[model samples]
Target: MDLDLKGSKVAVTGGSRGIGKSIATLFAAEGCDVSICARGPETIEKTRAEIESHGVKSFGTALQGRDGEAVRTWTRDTCDAFGGLDVLVCSLSAGGGTNDERYWYRSFEIDLMSATRAVEEAYPHLKSSENAAILVVSSMAAAETFVSPMAYNSMKAALITWSKQLAEQFAPKGIRVNCLEPGPTMFPGSNWEMIKVARSRTYSGVLRQQPTRRMAEAEEIARSAVFLCSPAARWVTGATLRVDGGYTKGVQF
Candidate 1:
C-alpha cells in the first residue's frame, strides 16, 4: 500500500498540464519533492503551487522541450534544489498531427531528445539514490497502427526501445528504467478533448473499439505511472506497461 516514495526527489518534463502534471502532483502526494518544466510559465506556477499544496517541496521552470540546453538546465537545477534525484518521468510530448513536415522535427525534439537529454543528465544523480527509477511516457499509438503516418508514433516507439536498453544498462547501477503506454487520454484542455469536437467521427470510431467506451483520465494513468517508478515496484525494469483500459487489443508477449 505504501509506495515507499516519501522523501524522494522527482523531475517531470512537460509536466505543467495533462498527464505530466498529474504524475508530478501524485509524486508530491506520496511525499516526494517534485520539480516540473513546461512551456507555459503560468501553468508551471499553478502546477508548482498544486504540488506544494501536498506538503512537499516543489520547483518549476518554463522551457520549450525543443531546447536541449534548457532541458539539461532544468534537470540540474532540480537536483541542486532537491539534493538528489530519485525518479525521472519524461511526460512532455509534441502531440500528434500529420499536416506538415514541421511535425517531424517537433516530435523528434520534444518526444525523443527531451527524454534522452534528461536521462543522460540525471544518470549520475540517480545512481546515488537508494530507490532510483525512470518512467518514460510513451503512447499506445506507437504499438499499433491507429492514425496515418506521423512522427509522434515513431518517436514514442523509440522511447520504449531506449527505455528497455537503459534498464538493462542501469540495473547494474541500482537505477531501474521502464516505459508506460497510455491509451487515448482525455482531460480538460487535452488534445483528445479538441478531437472530440473537431473530429467527431474519428473520436467515436476510436471509442467504439474500447470495451469500456471511455477514455482514461490523467489521474487514472498517473496512478499506474507513480507505482511503476515508486519504490514499491523496485524489481520492475525493462518493461512496457500499457495503461489503456483495454483499448488496445494486441496482446503483449
Candidate 2:
C-alpha cells in the first residue's frame, strides 16, 4: 500500500531515540525528508545519520524540548531547510512522574506544551502544504489507568482533546490533525526499559495485562503513526486512534 509519502517533509520531536526515532526512521524509509530534535547532540547526530542512510535528506537539532523558543526556532529551521513542512509528529515527552509540583510542571511543558508550541510554529507551513498533517503522540495511559497517578498520563489526555479541537479548526485549511495513543511500547533507552530494570514488579504487572505478554515495539507504533499522518489517511482527522495492541480495555463508542 503506497502511503503516497514520498518526498514529504517531516519533523519529529524527541526523535533521537525510542518511539520518536523510530517514527523518523520509518518516514525516511518511505522516501520522506526528515528532521528531528532532542536534547542529546550525540544521539541527534546518530539518528540523523541513520535516517539519511535510507537515502532521504535528514536534519537534526539538539535542544531542550521544554524551551518554547528553541522548539519554535527548530520548527522554523526545519521548515526552511525542507522547503516546507508536510507532517509534524509531536513525540517528545517527560514520562511518568509522581505528585511533585515540579514533575507536573515538567510534564506540562515537555509533554503538552511542546506539542502545542510545535503546532503553533508549524501552522503556517502546514497550512501551505497540500498534504499537511499533525500527529500528536499520546499514550494509552491517558485512557486507562496504569501505574499510580502521574502527570504524564494527564498531559497526554490533554493532547487528545487539543488534537481533536485542532483537527476541527484546521480541516477546512487542509491540515489533518490526529492523535495516536500507544500502550507500553518498549525500546532501547525507553522509560519502560528502565522500569524493567528498576521496578520489575511494575514491568511484570504491565506485561501480564497484555495477551501477548509483551509490550509493543517502537517500530510497530511508528508504522501506525506514519499511516495516520500519510496521504493514505487523507480523510482521517479529528480522531484518536489507539495503537495499543488491545492494552486499553475501554470501548470507544
Candidate 3:
C-alpha cells in the first residue's frame, strides 16, 4: 500500500515520544514532511532528527500542549514551512488522574482543548489541500469503563463527539475528521510503563482483559492512525476506530 502520501505536509502534537512519535515517524516513512511539538526541547530535536532521517522534511517546536497560542503558531508555521498542510493528528494528552479539580482543568487544557485549538488553526490550511484529514488520538477509556472516574476519559469522550461533528461540518469542504481509541499501549517512558512497575496489579488487570493478554505497542496504534489519515481511507470520516487489541469489551455497533 503506497498510501499515496508522498509530499504531504503533516502535523502532530506531542510527537516527541510514545504514540505521537510513532505516528510522525510512520508518516515520514510514507514520504510526508512532518512537524511536531512537545514540551521537552531535547526530545523534540531528537524526534525531528529521526523524522528527517527518513528523507522527509521535519520541523519541531518545544512547547506545552495546553498553550493554545503556541499550538496555533506551530500550525501556521508548519503550513508556511511545508507550503501547505494535508493531515493533522492531535496526539497530545495530559494522561489520567482523579479526584482533583485541578486535574480536570489540566486534562481539559491538554487533551481536549489542544485538539480543538489545533483543528481550528489548521482548518484553513487543511481546506486548501487536495486531500485533507484530521485524526484525533483518543483512548478506549472514552468508550469503555476501564478505570475510575477521571477527567482524561471524559475529555476523550468529548473529542469523539467533536470529531464526529467536525467531520460533518468539514465534509463539504473536502476535509475528513476521525478519532482513534487506543487501549493500554505500552512504550518506553509511557504512563503505562510506569503503571506496570509501580501499580502492577492495575496493569495486570488491564492486560487480562485483552484477549491477546498483552498491551498494544505504540507502533501498532500508529499504523492504524496513519491509515485513517491517508488517502487510502478517504471515505472514512466521523468514525471512531478502536485499535485496542480487544481490550475493549463493548460491541462497537
Candidate 4:
C-alpha cells in the first residue's frame, strides 16, 4: 500500500544511528527528501550517503542534540537543503549515568527538550504542507519502567504529554502529532550488555513479560512511524501508538 508520501520532505533528529537512522533510510526509500542530524560529523555524513543512495535527496549535519543553538542551525540548514519540510520525526535520546544530577539533566535536555526545539523549528514548514505530521519517538518505559534509568522514564513521560498539547495546538493547522512508544527493540546502538545485566538481576523479567517472547526489530517500529506520518493517518493525532509485542496486557495488580 502506498503511504502517499512520495515527494514529501522530512526532518529527523538523532538520525545518525540506531532507530533514527532506520527511520531516515525508510523515509528516503519512500521517495521523501530526508534530512537528519547528530553529534558525530562522520556518522552523520555516512547516514546522509546511505539515504542518498536510495535515490532521494538527503542531507545531514553534526549538531548536538542537547544544544538549542545547534538545533536551530541544523533545522535551518536542513530546510534549506530539502527546500521544504512536511514531516518532523523527533527521535532524540541521551545517556543515563549512575550520578544522579548528571543523569537527570542529560535526560531532560536530550529526550525531552531536544524534541521540543525540533518541533518548534519545523512548525512553520510543516504548516505549509498538505499532509503535515509530527511523530515523536518515545519508549514504553514512559508507561512502565523496565531496565531504563529513572531519567529515561521521566523524559519519555514528558514527551507524551508534550505531544498531546502540540496535537491540540496544531489541529487547526491540519498537522497531526503523535507518539510511537516501543518496548524492547533489537537496535544496533542499544546496550545489550546492560540489558543482559538487567535480565539477570532485575525486578521484572523482560523477555517473559512480552507476549511475543522475543525482542522487536527496528523495522517494526519504523513501519508504524511511516504509517503515522503518511496520509493514511491523517486523523491520528494526540495519540500514542504502542509498537510493543503485547507487553502491557491489562493491569497486573
TM-score of 2: 0.99
- lDDT (Cα, 0-100) at 139 in candidate 1: 95
Candidate 4 lDDT trough over 10 residues, lowest sum? 195-204
Better of 1 and 3 by lDDT: 1
The Cα error of candidate 4 at residue 125, in Å, is: 1.2
lDDT, residue 186, model 1: 94
TM-score of each: 0.99, 0.99, 0.98, 0.93
lDDT of 1 by residue, 116-144 (tens): 99999999999999999999999999999
Badly placed stretches (over 4 Å) of model 2 are none
User: In candidate 1, which residue pairs clash?
Assistant: none
* Candidate 1: segments with Cα more than 4 A from true spot: none
**Ten-residue region with minimum lDDT total, candidate 2:** 144-153
Q: List the residue pairs that clash in candidate 2.
A: none
> What digit string (tens of lDDT, one per residue) describes model 3 on residues 90-136?
99999988848999999999999988999998999999999999999
lDDT of 1 at 209: 93
lDDT of prediction 2: 0.94
Candidate 3: where is the Cα deviation over 4 Å? none
